[model samples]
Target chain A: DVKVTQSSRYLVKRTGEKVFLECVQDMDHENMFWYRQDPGLGLRLIYFSYDVKMKEKGDIPEGYSVSREKKERFSLILESASTNQTSMYLCASSSVKGGYKEQYFGPGTRLTVT
Target chain B: SQQGEEDPQALSIQEGENATMNCSYKTSINNLQWYRQNSGRGLVHLILIRSNEREKHSGRLRVTLDTSKKSSSLLITASRAADTASYFCATFIIQGAQKLVFGQGTRLTINP
Candidate 1:
């Protein structure tokens, strides 16, 4: 079975602070994504990485950045955390080599920006 | 903007009853998928149906897609309490690495 792991399950940060969320996958997938979930708004993509050192912006990428220095790890960075940024963060990974590749997700991290 | 929209934002049913949810997309898609999230946690993939296919099933779940209308429906037969969760439909576009666009989601509550 494929497994995706997140660095933290819950986090709290003060406003204007820097925050980092990490994700790692053991399946060696080529596609990795970051998403935020909010009530009524559904899930919005923040950023995605297709390969090492490659990144792409999704629907809502403002105030967020991503790093993919290695194939197994992806990091989401919040340069200046704000109260509006408090939400559930999810990480997913997928492979491009197969038919109808499904994404595997991590448990998610609930962040509270004070 | 969201590419897909799910109707009946919330649903309630008793055990052993059938539950159906509808999703409509704005653009052409290569495939559509169903996922379940429990209490704002990570999403678990349930099923995926390609554009060429009309219907697909796994276990007690059935999915149908209509390309002409650009809509899809998911049916859970004899739903159990364990099936209670938030359901989302995601559309996979044909271009740009096939990024998935998700819908607003439907909250399903099943009573025992």
Candidate 2:
């Protein structure tokens, strides 16, 4: 079974503080992604990593950065957390071995910036 | 970027009734997928229909993709109370690299 776990289910941070969200996948998937879900905006991709040490900016990557130093783990970084950055952060992984298939997601981290 | 737009932002129906949700995309896609997310939880992939395929099914879930019109529909038969969740339609763009664009999602409430 494919399992993805996030570091925290709920997190709170003050404005201008640095925040780090971690995600780990049991399966050796090559693709990992970070997304933020909001009320009416839906899910917006923040960043994606296809391989270790490689990253790509997604639609809403302005205040967020990502790191994939290891194959099994990915991290999302917020240099200066702000009130607007508070949202439900989700992590996902996909494998390219069989073909282009659906992505498996983690339980998600609800971050609140006060 | 958001490519798909789901119709009827919210739906309320009784259990045992069939629920249908529609999604329309703006560009060419390689495939369309349906995902369900429970309250404050991550999304679970339900079904994926390739651009060439018109329809596919799994359990009580049925998905249809219309490449020409860039539209898709998800039909859940005999809905159960546990089926209450948000349904999102994601599209794999032809030019997108292993990334899928998601819609705003439809909130489904099943009343028993």
Candidate 3:
């Protein structure tokens, strides 16, 4: 079984503070992604990384950035957390070997920016 | 912008009944996937259907894809209370290293 683990299930931060959410996958997948899910908005991609130190912006990349220093770990950074940034952040990883290899997701990190 | 959108944002059904959710996408896709997420939990991949294929099934779940309409439907047979969760349809577009775009998802409630 594939296991994707997130650094935190719940976190709180003050406005303008820097925040980091970490994700680690045990399956050695080549693709990793960060998304923020909101009611009526669903899961909007923030960033994705296909290889070490490589990153790509998704539809809603503003106010968010990501890092993939190693294959197993992917990090999402908020330069200046704001109340509007509060959301359920999800981490997912997938293998690109076959056509649409399913993505495995980690238990989301619910960040509250106060 | 979200590529896919799910209809009937919320659904309720009896335990023995079947639950169905529909998703529509904006662009061409190589394949479509369905995932289940219990409230505040990680998502679990349920099934995937390629653009060339019309329908696919796994256990009690059935998925159908229509390329012309750029839509898909997921059906859960004999749904149980445990099946209550959010069902999302995701598609892998043919562009830009093939990123997966997810829909808003349908919140399903299976009452016992």
Candidate 4:
């Protein structure tokens, strides 16, 4: 079974504070993704990494950055968090072998930017 | 913009009844996948149907895809209360690196 783990299940940060959400996968998957879920918006992609040191911006990448220094770890960074940034952040990883690979997800981190 | 849109944003059904949800996508897709998320939890991959396939089933779940209409439907037979969750349809676009574009999702409630 594949396992994806996040650093925190819940987090609170003041406005303008820097925040980091970490995700690690044990399946050695080549693709990793970051998404934010909001009511009526579904899950919007923030960023994704296809390989180590390779990153791509998804539909909504504003105010967010990503790091993929290693294959197993992906990190989402908010340079200066704002109240509008509060959301349920999700991380997912998938292998590159299949045409339509299933993405395994980590328990989301609910971030509250106050 | 979201690539897929789920119809009947919310649904309620009693146990032992079948529930169906529909999803429509705007662009060409390599494949369509279904995911379920319980309240406050991460999504679980339910099923996937490629563009060339019309229907697939696993356990009590059935998925149908219509490429001509760019639509798909998920049917849960004999839904149990545990089936209550938000169901999302995600598409693997024909152009991208297999990144999934997700729909807003349909909230399903199963009454016991």
Best by lDDT: 4
lDDT of 3 by residue, A7-91 (tens): 9999999999999999999988999999999998888889999899999999899999888999999999999999999999999
In model 3, what is the error at residue A8, expressed in angstroms?
0.6
Fraction of true contacts kept, per model? Answer: 0.75, 0.81, 0.94, 0.78
Local lDDT at B70 for model 2: 83
lDDT of 2 by residue, B1-102 (tens): 358999879999999999999999988888888999999999999999998899999999999888888899999999999999999999988775647999
List where candidate 4 sits over 4 angstroms from the true fold: B96-98
What global local distance difference test value does model 1 have? 0.94
The collision pairs in model 3 are: none
**Model 4 TM-score relative to the real fold:** 0.98
Q: Taking the tens digit of each residue's C-alpha lDDT, what string does model 2 give over A49-74? A: 88999999999999988889999999
Docking class of 4: high
The lDDT of each candidate is: 0.94, 0.94, 0.92, 0.95
Q: What is the interface RMSD of each candidate, in Å?
A: 1.2, 0.7, 0.8, 0.6
What's each prediction's TM-score? 0.97, 0.97, 0.96, 0.98
Docking class of 3: high
Per-residue lDDT for A39-77 in model 4, tens only?
A: 999999999999999999998999999999999999999
